[model samples]
Target chain A: MIGCYDFCGHYEWTFEWLSQLGGHTLVRAYWDEAVHQDSQTHASKLIREKGFEGMKEYWGPTLADEGAVYERTVTDDVFRIDMHECPSKGFLLRNGLEQYRDYCDHCMGWIGPLMKDAGFVIDHEHNHCGQCWWEIRRKDDATPASAAGELSGASDVRLRPGWQSPHTDHYERSTDPDDKTVVS
Target chain B: MASSIPASLPYADTKPAGHADFYFAVNATFRFILRHHGEGALRKYWQDIGQSYYQPVSKRWSELGFAGVAEYWRAFFAVEPGAEVEVSEAQDEVRLEVKTCPAIRHLREHGREVVPNFCQHCFFVNEAIAEPAGMTVRVCGGNGSCTQRFMKATADLPPQNLEDIATAS
Candidate 1:
């Protein structure tokens, strides 16, 4: 049960792409036993109880069968086409896709139609790709280490009150690069 | 007929070889700090030690003590919680009981090293990582859900002189 919340808008397109992955599927049911239309409720419960295996077992076969057909429809790489080509539509590729330029191009092409269909405001003013954004934010003045840390909220794990996990403390401590060494 | 100095010990006013040797050994030990613990962390840890940005600190490990060392380790390395920690003396300097059998298998089968699997909720390895066990990793966390096939370690490789470390044989 790959539980995903907020799938009402552009995520529907993502769901379509996910459907093509071999031996993976999305079921509109709970427990793979009960008939349920609310994918959110069913997905949430199914994820907590049955996990990814259950999601695959219920959805995989169907998606795998239609994999080729789905790929043909959403063919172009929706990301990495060009900032100018389709700036707003390119934001769909989110899985650290800096390596695969071709894949991003295909995704950008594929998702451009979907983005338009979804009615998201296409903002061309912001041409910054994810890597570019990272670099801009990581400038010395920006204090990116702290900003990144705060945004991630990787700190503040109050586990068992007064029994704070060392991991959380460690993360908080590392926020200050002066006091910490970034060892990969 | 006149002794220049009073001899209460084996030698008067002259330090023993062991005492001098201890200091010499400590000087050697400090090299490890520079090699691993970055100069910035060392400076922050020991503020008054006069560790300058230009002059990197390859000294002062003994002065920092165990707690300081622990903090250094915690900062530098990513350790999975369930990887059994065996601390001999200080709260730091723990021997992590990492089961590398799965990693070995992964290397053999996929030609890649596998990071230890961590539970989404607890951030600890779900079970003892062993051979024949699939390399299951943290799929999600409290903050956001993670999809399967996401290795805990990022794809970025660390800086290393691999050839120097490799055996000639």
Candidate 2:
């Protein structure tokens, strides 16, 4: 899921306004700023310590190896995994999130493909919460009918519900866990 | 034109006497129609109202947006007081305009910089766009071009999943 911390540049102006009105006591007003700032910093630190290249590559092919690809709006199952990034190496069990877990059934599941599809492939994956080690992957496949253009438009004008208030709480920042899995 | 209520219009605990009658009647009519027919009737009712008002109201139907007709009706009722309103089949596409009055008020009370609206990325999210990895989009609330596009979270699959050879292979 594209959380709030992705676009820090655009929110700088909003923060300036909130800071003036809130002053020192404007904890609510500065919450988003604080979250974005912290996430960016944390992400950068992780990048530096690992000496990884680019945002996408930071996870390395090792993480991508165990990836799963699901069909467009199909089901709660994964199709495949690379041996290098498999749970045998323990990466899947360590960094998995929870949002990927809840689904058609309450049972635990991975989000890889059991078969190969034509237009789409897995793009990014995360666990539901940082528990249970079930992997969830965000699939990136285009529909057959004008899928490319539709996706381009979908990316700009209509993604989430239009009525979401701007002041909702932002995503929380968690420090790198000692239990977190890292691959060289 | 309807009279503009003072910015500091007194907040009343009870409905105004004269307006209360129409308000109650309207509310009751809505409830009665909704109770028997469900929301379908209300939607049709509004559609009919849109059709009736389409011609006599204005030539810029699209510009009227959702609020335009609503405002027109509000103004019409204020003047006519007891006019019986009805609508028929109407063919028009109405646009909805987002109001930033709360944002405006916050700016006025607090300071110029206060963002009375959500972040640009958030705006995209509200529109159902999720990732916004590429593509250039211009934001309306403030100045500057917001380059982010919208994307979506992956869909959850159903239970008893099948390994579509298309997906699995």
Worst 10 residues of 1 chain B by lDDT: B9-18
lDDT of 1 by residue, A1-184 (tens): 1011111111233223223321122211111111121212222344335433333343344333212111101112111111122211232232222222122222222222223223211111112231111111111232322232232132312112332222111111111111212121
For model 2, how does the per-residue alpha-carbon lDDT over B17-62 read when each residue is reduced to its tens digit? Answer: 1221122222222333344445554344333322331223332222
The per-residue C-alpha lDDT of model 2 at residue B138 equals 21
Where in model 1 is the C-alpha error above 4 Å?
A1-74, A77-184, B1-63, B74-87, B90-109, B113-169
Question: Candidate 1's residue-wise lDDT over B90-121, tens digit each?
Answer: 34222222222121222234322111121121
- Please give, for residues A1-184, the per-residue lDDT of candidate 2 as tens digits: 0111111111222233333434433323133223222212333344344322322342343233323221122123322211122222132133221121112111111111110111122322123221122222223323122222142233311122331222111111112111122211
Instruction: Report how closely model 1 matches the true complex, as a DockQ value.
Output: 0.01
Q: What is the TM-score of each candidate against the true structure?
A: 0.18, 0.17
Error of 2 at A163 (Å): 56
Off by over 4 Å in 2: A1-184, B1-20, B58-169
